[model samples]
Target: MKRLIVLLQVFLIGACLNKELTNDQELQKPIIQSPWVENPDEIGHDFYPRPQMKRANWENLNGFWDYAILPKGEKLPTLFDGQIRVPFAVESDLSGVLRKVGENQELWYRRSLSLNSLQDGKRFLLHFGGVDWESEVFVNGKSIGVHRGGYDPFSFDITPFIISDEDQELCIRVWDPSDQGPQPRGKQVNIPNSIWYTPVTGIWQTVWLEEVPEFYISSLKNTPDFDKKTIEVLAIISSESVADKVVVKALDEGMLVAETAVTPGEKAELKIQNPKQWSPKDPFLYDIEISLMQGDQELDKVYSYAALRKISQEVDENGIQRMMLNGEFLFQYGPLDQGWWPDGLYTAPNEEAMLFDILKTKEMGFNMIRKHVKVEPAQWYYHCDRLGMLVWQDMPNGDHGNVWEHRLGIVGKATDKQRSQESEQIYLNEWKAIIDANYNFPSIVVWVPFNEAWGQFNTKEVTEWTIDYDKTRLVNSASGGNFIMDGSKITGHMIDLHSYPEAVMPDPNIFGKDNILVLGEFGGLGLPIAGHTWQNEDNWGYQSFTDKEDLANRYKQLIDKLEELIQKGLSAAVYTQTTDVEIEVNGLMTYDRKVIKLDRDWLRSLHQKLYDLEIQINQ
Candidate 1:
């Protein structure tokens, strides 16, 4: 405890943390919030932000918070400008303060905490789901700590700051440079233009508080061994402090399937009689309860869930490499899901609205989603895990200098940028944090480090390092970006290419011999409906259609081509996008999500063929 307090005092940090055209200036166009936001407090974001490891005794600190914008290096302000909604960025309409905090400015937030009937002998922790760029925290005017990453969650033990159960003031100071710096601000820019979006500043995710005993389970790392019919869990204790032992129990519908116990840092293995493997067709999940115990006394208990699945690569009889999920060749097809909201920017107005996109994707008969170049809140991935969506999670790319804008597929130039030491370190730190944060999710099958050469550096080294770091998931070094070929083989696991308007695959004869061939991005068929679009003017897609019928017909033609590519060893393909973002109208659905441009039955029927298309090989 003394060491923890000492380290918290000197917390000075300097760490940090993609598509399409058209820009709408000063979007003053009578933007209506999603019906989901109509009763923002009624139903939203109350779900456990970290679903994998959930405790019963935790406070949800996601309501109105007093905020002020101050100059950089300025002292804490005694008076705030106004109230801004917590867990929403100030630049977002949902935040109630549509403003931008640039590099020269700092965003300050304050809220009072009145702790009553506090649990005895328990430590209090204040957690922020996520804050943009850099953030500093203060409790009752005493500086606690600071964090720099914009996407990953962080917390501080505020038990020491709680003044005898009185009203305690909690404040946070945040500064984000957005695209102005080398941080990983994916698709965010100060000046909005073709493919860049309005800046998101300050806290954009839920803020909460949790209490625990002195020695409790902080995190659980669960790994399911599909072949061995067992699950291994390692419970990490708070502050690396030791508990006597931790017990892991696996249950199926409240029936205990297996149970085991081991020391806190040691792996506890539970052998199952018969494991029901998780797949897109049947995403069976086993309920997990992790408990920390000292002798006969249980100190902490956290509820979690895990799925038994395996991802591997196999060479077909035709000598084409394929992605094997659970030892089966399942051709993956989904959209380039850019998880953005017109009103919420990087966030959705509510939880149901957030799940709507994923639910619609499943309804549209898609089995996978390439989460394009941006990290979402944990709940978003939790939905995918439960709904059985295979995910290709991209590490949000940034520090752009060698951005391959025009050099597209087949005849495109593959370029690698030389980043400064600080920039490279920033990328590495944030990339690791993102992976570690989302590592436990069973839905994510692939980790994409770079997309389309945006801030791509040391491809071979980074790709190899990611592979070494997490051997469970496949690494796409530079998705649809530079295919840095080492002799004949590319640096990444998949040979990915980007082509607009039509689906295309890498030549199986050339690169498919070793790498899994995939169409990383294609099909930007746009049919913007009036009143549902972000802006009435300048809304564009790669190919614009006047009517839904024409769009469907064109999409059918693309699917026909994809069927041919599937036979030519294409293992997976990602459509241009799930919905229109800002003025770029290339989406299956409009930006507002009120109108789904494609007919559900028609699109699903057309998509089912791609999934059923068997790779015919000369026997």
Candidate 2:
């Protein structure tokens, strides 16, 4: 306890001390925020964040927070400038304060929240859905914890630091060096331009506090066994003393569906009669009410949900390897979601804005989206499941690799081969961390090992390593370029031909081996809406258009081109992106997410056609 107090003190002070920032030149233009929409408190995220495991009483720490950005080498500000909604980056307009916290500065956030109904004797835990790069947390000036990874969720038990009062001051100091730092900072850079976007520093995810009982449920691991028609459930109980027995019950609308008894560290399989399968088209969720009992006495209880689905790779009728969703081949098509907003660099303006992207993608007749090189808040995946959208998740890339080594690929020029090895190890660790963090989402059907060879090294080993790590999902060994065919042929090496704008199917007769043909990325059509662009001079797209109508027509033509490719053997194709990022004006919508560049009806018509085409090929 004495050591813990000293450590907390050091952590609290450290958050204030760290200042690896850069010289800040004022941003050319400022971002804008959207008006707040009234939402229900009860069903706020009424849906479960984690499809695999969930809790009922868990509190969501999203709402407004007081923020201040002090220059590097400066002391903490005496007073905060204004309030900014958390889970959103400082540069994001939705955060209420659009400002830049360069590589050499520390961004500070302080919020005083009062807990209302934290039942007596319950242990309170503070949870941060995610924080960029490095973060240190403090409750009432007493340090609670510190975390390194920016994408994964971390929680600290604040029961010890609690002052026995309802009101508590939560302060967090964040430092993110974007691309300049060795951390897994994805495509973010200080100088925003084509392909790279504005830096997202500090808390870019939900920051909430939850009250749990002493010896409460920590994590729920749900694995679906398709062959056996069983769902393996493991409930990890957080306890001071060893748990003797635990009980789990699955229910739908108060009716008993399944129940099981188990010992700590043991998995319990719950079986049902003719379970309703879960898919993008039909996302059936089973409500679960888990109760941890000590000999018929309920000590702790929480509610959650899960879907029964499976993803795999298999040979199709045409003798081509295809992605199988629940034992059926389905051609996945959707936007390349970078998960950035004009207002919220890492966070969305609201939950509605998050849903709008996925819903619009589905509405436009695309069944899947490739979330490019960045992990999103759990709610993003939850929205995908609810709205019937397939997801291909990309592990965030870290460390600079050889640019010369990737000259032949779409990843642009990287750093160098020899230097990339050191980056390779860092990439592997961060990828593993990302995988472990997001492995629970049912929407994520495929894992992209390397994107166009950005910081890519030991391609064959990395591909095989990813496969070995999690064989449950399909693996895109390498998206485009560096066609050293290895790992699973799901991502048909960009061999047959390179540099094609439209969807290109893989050649099945390639050396007598079948591969899943997918256009990992293509169609970077640029349409910079007059006032919606990040920069006027540097803004550029793959194929620039003069007006919205021309942009829409060109987009439709590219997608129409997909219809022909779908017939040949294209399993999946990802449009360049969903919304404009920085100067890259290829998003289906404007950077603010206010303008749908394409006609809604026309997009939906295209979606129907694509879905019908995909189902027919499988049949």
Candidate 3:
């Protein structure tokens, strides 16, 4: 038996080496590669996707998978076109197959898994962090299940379908109509241009398998209350038999600060003495551990973390409404971050590449980012929580039939789009799932439901529901887009307006007393570097500039105007973007992230002027 085990180990090592060589030779070279793309081991996103609920036993199913693109409604083909990298969209250069799977086609993926990794009497869960549009799963040619939403995570229990002695065959079918369908696809279009980008089809995130007990912890919701100095935790457990009890622990730098035992599915309130508050300047998080118990035996355990903070709006000493962080008024200013990549499309080339953007944003003297019309992997938010950056997350937009009047000078209310019942339900379901999945991240301070007028419908009802569902965060019903008016007054918590080429805010005299005025978007100044642009000819910006000195000077002028608006009760502002996307050259950085379009020190000094005004407000 010892000799047999030695022989098996050798064979497995040889197989992995052979597979690596094949992957390198079979995949297509990317047109433009990031710094981390040279190494084969760093090709896919291999980190643990879910950080809020983490366990010890899991396997990453990223690397290479056999892929074939065939006509729609066709049966699975026995022969594959080639090997494509998992988690990168098929149309992306990193996928090793830069081929478009259009509305009339379907993308297929196949991989083989060994069941020897599974322990006896343990259930195996297959998880897909994200798959675009529609997906169907199959094991050993038997159908498992189907999922429709594109931006949310989905999982399946595949223990029963596995054969104990033989290797398991896993296959997936994905169909994404992109902009042609009513599904929520943000900025993806068939023909990429100006603001629209290349469509991402099939899996674009981490795919993995996890081992769990028959009864295990499914999910967790953490809400922090600074006034009460307590953290509320709600753990959802799955089981056939009722769990005897649940143990929750709060640790500060590895020392136990608070702990409690409660019944399964019950809310547990853990109190701490003089808890550290979380803010952009000092982000302190308390680690948490939860375990499902039966008598004295522990069935399962998961790790998480939370912060103690509060966000609200109130009247200041100057009699102007201001956005407050913790308890004091703060002037929020940041870029409109559209999370996209040149090589990987929807997915970043590597974890380091993803962190570079957030770090650079901070280095540029910004404290927050409005994640414009897109949701990112949980790890992105995790970095924000640890590194201390506030986030205003937007729901992905889709299904547009109404005409969006870009009434730049007009201030009256805009009409909401009339969507069918099916479209409305789809939008609501996905929005709720997104909010629930990301509720624990402390960096997220605002939930933005609509952008401009692109799929806006039933604005009043949706905004009210979002506020009711999660009272901890503020809700921006529409960002610089449409305004659902309650008679003459605008709905939602903030009055947002969009202006191009410069900063502008709503007239404080008309909307100041009731709502916090904000310049949701402005200053899309364009400066396209020769080699860094997506295209040389058609690239454009809201206002075009030539040299770095000119861009810096123009941006400073915009900041000067913004300071004046702040004096007029502008509570927050979001600049055009953090990075240039596609043919739009209005970003602080170029598309490839290789160049900063303007002077960094000069820009930081200019931004300091905005932050200085916040100090004056407090004084």
Candidate 4:
């Protein structure tokens, strides 16, 4: 791990903390058998990981793996020092390796497993839920896979590398420089402070294996048409011969809606009448069962679902552009979700923990969450769908060059067009992968290309391409800063003009001209709980408050000001954050998912009023 140049006193303190980490050491002591804390009997974690696409046979390799940190350009470590859990980033407490693999270091992981259990005429596939920047994997020291991008899932067919009856060794290597590299890394820095946190390196997400047929469905893409009340389905197969005879079976409420077989590359359409629309209030999801067969012989099968919905911007009665969901204007009240956990960092400690954040937000009266910069696990979106939450997904930023803009407050200007182009291509590729991965989920309605000019460039092209890639969702060209007035909404950052417990509604007339008015950011309420912060003393937010009551009082006042703006033209707003992350102590919940800083009832009241305004505007 890369060492930080800290004061001698602070370095000694960190060394003491490292020595005091006993529970994690105990957790890592078991070698042959991992000391996994599988709280299956616990609430929330038992739900299936993926809701949109369901498969019956799969195993989660999330417990423990041998890990070691090496110096720059060092060969793979010869011996493992200890163990760390898969899926959880090194910076997270749950990983059992609470250290930073900064720009100058490398992380290595190795594990051995028997594949004999997967020998029932089933093919073996290796899957990575997500990795920070770059990763390379080898099975039995034979290179099998390489993947890039920090937020998209990728897989490799390891059938050739594995002898089904033998114990195969899996090895992985990763490198991430966080903010130092000109990559789409968001808010990660070696020197953590303020908005930035410690860099996450190596396998930060789930590393698992699945058993499937030789020729199986690789992915499913769904497009919904609210006007016709129909959905279009396109299933991609691994091979071409099986593609020509692809058959789709659509199911709703456990009943078959329609059955049709089409050529692999063509759109297979299914129609429904007066479909139950999906929203924060009524998140109705129709089930779908699909099977591909050739002459009565089942080749492959999978289960998925979709919802009929539309999101757009339209002129309201007062001649101001308003965000319309399902053809009616609605005021969107949500939180700025950073998607981090104290224990799991990038991965949640348990699945329920993931759902808890969304459900708690909804209970607090929010209908949406601006998934800031980071893309979450598929299960995260599934929870949002079932619990009734809206999402604005941001493409993870990379390729350097946005640091100056952030400091100078000159957002949305491209410094070097060359780097911007490279970053844009990478962004598009990952965005398409994310869109394709979650295309079936109905909760996500908007795509945010850039945030506050963090690696932002070519907004018009990126926004246009997003619309072309997925016509069903709205695209906010940029959020929290800058305006080219090209996309669907005119978003503004309204907070901390003087104090942290602050809020502002941008002049509706700016977006009332053509774009819908939206407060992309607001309400950075901060309260650092004792024993619940990454760094106790130096913890900071936009503004700091001493007590919960004071924070709540100021929050209510901010909401009241926002309410007045909604009466004028504001259509949507996002609170500062869903949970506190690293040194930024400005979240409704603490970093460890322990407590809610504000009274639940008080938070819910604010949301109830926001939703009520939405209904009124639509009427």
Candidate 5:
């Protein structure tokens, strides 16, 4: 009996210690989470990152990765702290290791991937959809290469680094200074605040591997000429030997609508008879197939897509410069989408979560969305294209060395920040790459280069360059940015102004003839619902309200003012935001995407007024 009692005591002590350890582990976990935060799949972000350019066989390398955070100068740790979910930043809750990687620390990730037998002369490429600031990749302990620029997709040829058919080790080292550096990191910051939120370090997007032929098509540039009823495609091929020809095909619902053949590197014009125009009402997309052929044999084949659309600036019946879509003067209205998530900082929890925002924007009767300050995944744009939503994409801002003087009502000249040669080069390179990368999306109608003068520089020159680069789309060089003026002319396609709590527009009487007048940003109405906020203490908005009823009333009043401005000459308007982010509670939906602040039916009814006016005017 004494021995049995002693054994029971020991068992009880061990149980208590185990319980304490479990509690401590729970405490270390992330508190805030999204609705989709379940056990991660074997391959996270398994969906094809590039829908525009897709191949049949590719491996998703995005499940669990051994991670370690060490001092900036420290070598790679032999042992890892724990397993973290790939494609999620260290600071994000869904990463499984919600720890801050400070500016002084380097984040490392290690994993192993097994490969199947590959065809002879084929090359294997490791692709990263995006990584925060800087990344160095290694395969089988062999250094592959490094890539910078957080918002762009990059790939490296890993054929030479793959040493064995067995599991090969993959390692990545990342360093991100966030706001400390001069990189264009959007709204990421170390400390959370009213507007700025968490910093995303290391890989925050899909990592995959693709096997392709030695000679392959590198990229496709599709441009639709609405008047000519022809789609022009430029297939860029990378090959050591000259390819015989390139074949392009456009299909509608599986039937071939148009097909053409041209020289490998030249442009192929595929003529479509009675091409269905892509618009917010009827978003029609034609599936495309491109093949690189050597005489009678096909070397490589890729699947792509395109839409027939056009955007331009023209004088309407009211003698005002109006933004025209598909040769018609249509008013665009939507929310200013920041594209941040509570669970996933830069990435959405899943494709559904990403599509939810766009779907909700449409459900709320908004025809457009101004992607504010940040870029989203390629699939996000794909959703927009298919769902028939207009997009105005902003170039992520960086290098804030100049003071911005708001000249909302007054005629403001461009505030030129004399950026260093290096800073200017970085900005220019990234901006150009972003444009080139996203050029194929049909939903993007406008390219906003600067926002409210955040890192504004060389306004006139940049505006001209953008116009020259892609004449297919209109350029709002500075959306609510410092208006660059030449006497009476504000240089750019649009003249925009931002007002808080209520809607306002650029003075039509002053600059109505030359530029399209728009309310780039306005009506940041805030109502923080308890239990749905990022934090209870410091949650805020431009105009705070206690209840949903009061918030809706205030929003209705703002729309009434906006309707009055529409008659005065406003062509488009972007409401403050789509969802609450961090402490700023001005979103139509909560940060966790749990609640819609206002009644959707009522909001939609109110928004229909703007489109009704456009229809009446056109009639």
Candidate 6:
């Protein structure tokens, strides 16, 4: 992978610990797999990776693959080092190769392909759910394509390189600088310490193959108009000629609600009468089907889904700006979910384990989740979409050279980090790809381009550009720093402030005049369990507690303060986290999700009060 001069922030909160980690300490780590992980030695994730738009004629190639760690300039391995599990990072325990491949080395993976289902007059597409940083693909030793940006999915057409009749071979080479280079690596470091965790290199998501016709549907972009009761779909087609059209259908429980036909490049608007609006209380998704057609023949058909939900803002009767969900004010409260796993650093052990966090968050009376500075797999968003959970997606933070020094409950204006032209373009490209990849998911209500001003530059331009690109959702330009509340330079849809250990917000009289006021992060009440932690000793939180009762009481106090702030026009709030990660022990649950540090019922009761304000949002 290419390298850039991205330096570290001079100051990182929390004193440095674990500076002298040894191989013995790594050996002593217990196997802390999730409860939903079926097998520890053998990983299993057979579910379809891409759920937003799916086709039946696909094969999951996620079992075992030969892997080798070689020098950065070394050629593709002729002699494999060993077998590493596909989709799991090489450093993960489940991969059977808990070894770090640093910037000096590159990770190579190759596996035999099965073409038993190969069909005549069909095209084959090789797909990788995600490969960290950068990756190059090869089919039968013929170079196919190279893909950058690990957080987004990519694929290549292998029909040209496929040796159809005989056996096939698929190979990939991945190089990730992790924290050593300038990339959007969130909470990852070459050496794990404090809040930063171990580096994740190589394929961290699923890999598969798909079969399609020559003129197949490449992608679908859906936009819903709740006011007009209509859903518009643009089915992009990959074809040799431009004589094809597409038919779009919106269905309710297998029955048709609306249907329309338009050219493949044009948007097909389907109008629905009396549409059922989706909300946190009742998330109703309409099934959709798009078919590529000639004059009288249907060539390809794909299935997808969408929701008729609206995200907006309005001035309240008290002359304060409030975030509106479905034309009503609804409190958005949830944990700052860092999508990490004890066993799987970047990838989940399986689909069930991935869904477990979202399920428990809902059960604990959370309506929204601020996915902290990291993007999750599409399946995670799909779960939230189906389960009626709101999401505020973040562009994973990296290239940290700016000043983000907000002490506990302190506030100030920070300087923007100056970035190289390459670094800036990298950020822009990945940000757009991340949005395009997950645009169809109804769960995502807001998009955060920067958090705590990490690598934040040209904020006004970035925010305005994002707003112009996708008007369907709100954008938080900077989540936690450089407050622009005087209405002079209000950049994005919201103005956020960072508070710690206690609930606090900007003055609604000032901030709420131009922007939606929110507590971007607060209430890091921590109670680390005895045996469930990444490290045995020196585990920490913003405010550490020893007992469950004390933590619960402290949390209640914070929630009480939050309720008062909500009354004063705090539009939304995000707690510190959902679970403890690595050595930072500020979570309601332990790292492995085995123990709940606080009473779930009490949390639910406390959270319900925030939602059950005077302005009730209808289901």
Question: Of the candidates shown, which would achieve the greatest lDDT relative to the real structure?
Answer: 3
lDDT per residue as tens, model 3, 572-598: 999998988988999999888989987
Q: Please, what is the TM-score per model?
A: 0.93, 0.85, 0.93, 0.87, 0.93, 0.93
Residues 1-619 of candidate 5: C-alpha lDDT, one tens digit per residue: 9999999999889866743342113213434556776655522566899999999878888878999888787766789989988899887777888777756778999998788765686888898888988899988777789877888888998877776557888999998887777778889766555677778888999999988888988888999898788889999987664678999999999999999999888899989977899999999999999999989899999999999999988876667788888888788999999998888888888887888899999999999999998888899999999999999999998888776665775765446898889888878988888898899999999999998888899989999899999989998978877888855788888988888977888777788888999989998999888888877677899999999888888899998988898888889999989998888999999988889988788889998888888522332
Candidate 4: the clashing residue pairs are: 44-352, 87-205, 182-399, 182-400, 183-398, 183-399, 184-397, 184-398
lDDT of each: 0.85, 0.70, 0.86, 0.72, 0.85, 0.83
Return the lDDT, model 5, position 472.
Answer: 91
What does candidate 3 score on TM? 0.93
Judge candidate 2 against the unseen true structure and give its global Cα lDDT, from 0 to 1.
0.70
Writing each residue's lDDT as its tens digit, candidate 6 over 486-594 gives 2364689888887778788877765667788888998887777887888778999999889988888888899999889888888999999999988889988888889
Report the lDDT tens digits of candidate 1 across residue range 390-478: 99999887899895743433535656799999999989998998888898899999999998889999988999999999988888888
Q: Could you tell me which residue pairs clash in candidate 5?
A: none
Evaluate model 1: give its TM-score.
Answer: 0.93
Residue 597 of candidate 6: its Cα lDDT?
80
- Rank ordering of all candidates by lDDT, starting from the highest: 3, 5, 1, 6, 4, 2
In the range 1-619, model 2's lDDT, one tens digit per residue, is 9999999999767644532223333343443333232232321233344444555566677667787777654544558878877667777665666677877777888887776644566887787778887788878887677787778888898877766546878888787778777777778877654577778788877776677777888887766766576677787788653456777766655777888888876897878557877787798766666677777777777666666788876665666556678888777888889987665677765677677788877777778989988898887887776666788888776665545333322333333244344555667776787787676567788888666556656766777777787766777766664555444442332232223356555564652145566777788888888877765566878888878888777777877887887776677788887888777888888877767888878887876676577433233
lDDT of model 4, residue 163: 61
Error of 4 at 197 (Å): 0.7
Which is better, 2 or 3, measured by TM-score?
A: 3
How far in Å is the alpha carbon of 50 misplaced in model 3? 0.7
Better of 3 and 6 by TM-score: 6
- Pull out the clashing pairs in model 6: none
What TM-score, to 2 decimals, does candidate 5 have? 0.93
Which whole-number lDDT from 0 to 100 does residue 556 have in model 4? Answer: 86
